[model samples]
Target: MSHPHLHQPRCLAGIVIYRPEFEALRGLVVSLSGDVATVAIYANSPISGEQQQALRKAASPAKLVILRPGLNRGLGAAYNALHQLAQADGNAFLLLLDQDSAPRPGMAGALMATYRRLAERGERPAAIGPQPVDLAGEKMQLPAAARQNGEKPLRASFVISSGSLIHLDAMAAIGGFRTDYFIDAIDIEWCLRAGAAGYSIWVDPTVPMPHRLGQGVIRLPLGLLLTDQPPRRLYTYVRNQLAMLRLQHVPVRHKAKFLLSLPVRLAVHLVHHRFSADCTVALVNGLRDGVLVRLGPPDRALIPFWRQGWRSRATTPRNTAAVPAALRQS
Candidate 1:
């Protein structure tokens, strides 16, 4: 299964960094340098000059460009910026990577080969991604419809943002990632939109990338595995899923499934957090803002309350409704 274009530098790799582990980021950059034309590091968190120099050194031979926005602009914004960079640089494809993902050396090549095969058969593929394997060596499960039948790429409903190789033209036609989504569900929303736009999403099951979803997995009875996400992440997870349900382009079946599981998900979070007041407030406010279509950054008033070690007796407003209408509007 040799791809003649395996070493071709037609792709631009974009890695989004947010308080990432230094060695992990450096390793990722090194792994991708030889395969892609250029490696672009989008710093969602501030990076010191010393770290920048070290990263540039790690990305040797391949050009490295660091995009420092000087603020946390969310995953979608970073991807959108990377997409623009890909277009401007005239690269054929864009490879999106999160800081935590550890892609195998030839992952990008495998994805591109699959994309080519699909195109040869007249299938319009918007993007192709590698199958993700968690640290425990367990492969992420795909829906039955998405399973690979033969040599063809798996027809996934959506693939995670990390390890995904997106065709520049297809991305242009579908429009870039949604900045409003901020951090969560950015990939799912984009894939759904791509499907609606008559383009297919594929997964190269033969290619596996090491990726972790949240803090870790919480194994409960009956073999249920819930990702252990922080309260802030929990807020966006609930909020974005609810927001997606309102979009017409999002599939009806997906929305139905989410609605059925929403309550259970909330219950699990409550128990996981040990009924912490911060978790309760985040969940409640997520629901309220999601229903009200307050789609932007997280509500300002709730920020301090959800952070680590904030006293519950501090008496902060629990929901956006409690914030002044003027402040909420802001």
Candidate 2:
């Protein structure tokens, strides 16, 4: 975690946690200790007594600043909270992580070094991220743009939320993450807006971070895809992606890509999953909401949809569950 070139003093590290395993969270925080000036954990889920004690004990050595707002504010809102904290503390960069990501040695240093090199070469990058080495899936998805950058770091459309070292001023200029997105596609939307504001997004393959996408993935003839997420998440993914389709800032190619790929994905989910009917209903509802520009958290109208899915699963004979643990909503 030692950063030899720690000249730029204001690098803050933060993670957004929901219901997480105590040991895993502790390991992640310990990994960040020597690399960052300050570490903040924004817990958006209710913590059990034992879990809280374990987190406190883990933080004692690292001296973490943990903030729990007493409710699940979703990913983008929690990220916005971190952005405000970074801004107020006058930090130059914010290293964002998911609760599960386990940083390897020099992970932060690699990102920071790449940022400095890119800046020296006259590239104003909005953020730089490390290559994600999935713990469960063991697969990595790099943007096509990654292959063209040669020796330098690859310029990409958007990086994953975790293992991303974001430039604070650039994010401030682009108005930060959109809370309306709530969960899915928040990073993509922010990247699109940043690009529209003339900022680049780069990925340094040399710095690989151990991350997990879903709890696990399924092998299909087409490819390896994430297991069936919860119906509510499926709805959010559809709605947010469609919402992106309406934005001018989002690249047309990305919009077209989504238009083509999302249906195939939906078909796959409907085919292999036990909750096919629920997924279909969720997709339809999502499409309707997306078309109407209904943004923000799922309101009371959507609660029945979730309840219906749960009831249907409960009544089933075998009770096959599709949602993965890592992808479960808190």
- Who wins the TM-score comparison? 1
* lDDT digits (tens) for residues 96-204 of candidate 2: 9998688875577678889989999999999998877777535377665545645568889899889899989887787767777677888888887888999999988
Q: Each prediction's TM-score against the native?
A: 0.87, 0.84
Compute the lDDT for candidate 1.
0.78
Global Cα RMSD, each model: 7.5, 8.4
**lDDT of every predicted structure (CA atoms):** 0.78, 0.73
What is candidate 1's lDDT per residue for 218-247, written digit by digit as tens? 887887677888877788888788878778
Model 1: lDDT of residue 279: 86
Task: List candidate 2 segments past 4 Å from native.
Answer: 1-6, 47-63, 136-139, 145-151, 222-227, 300-330
Best by lDDT: 1
Which residues of candidate 1, in runs, are more than 4 Å off?
1-9, 144-151, 220-222, 301-330
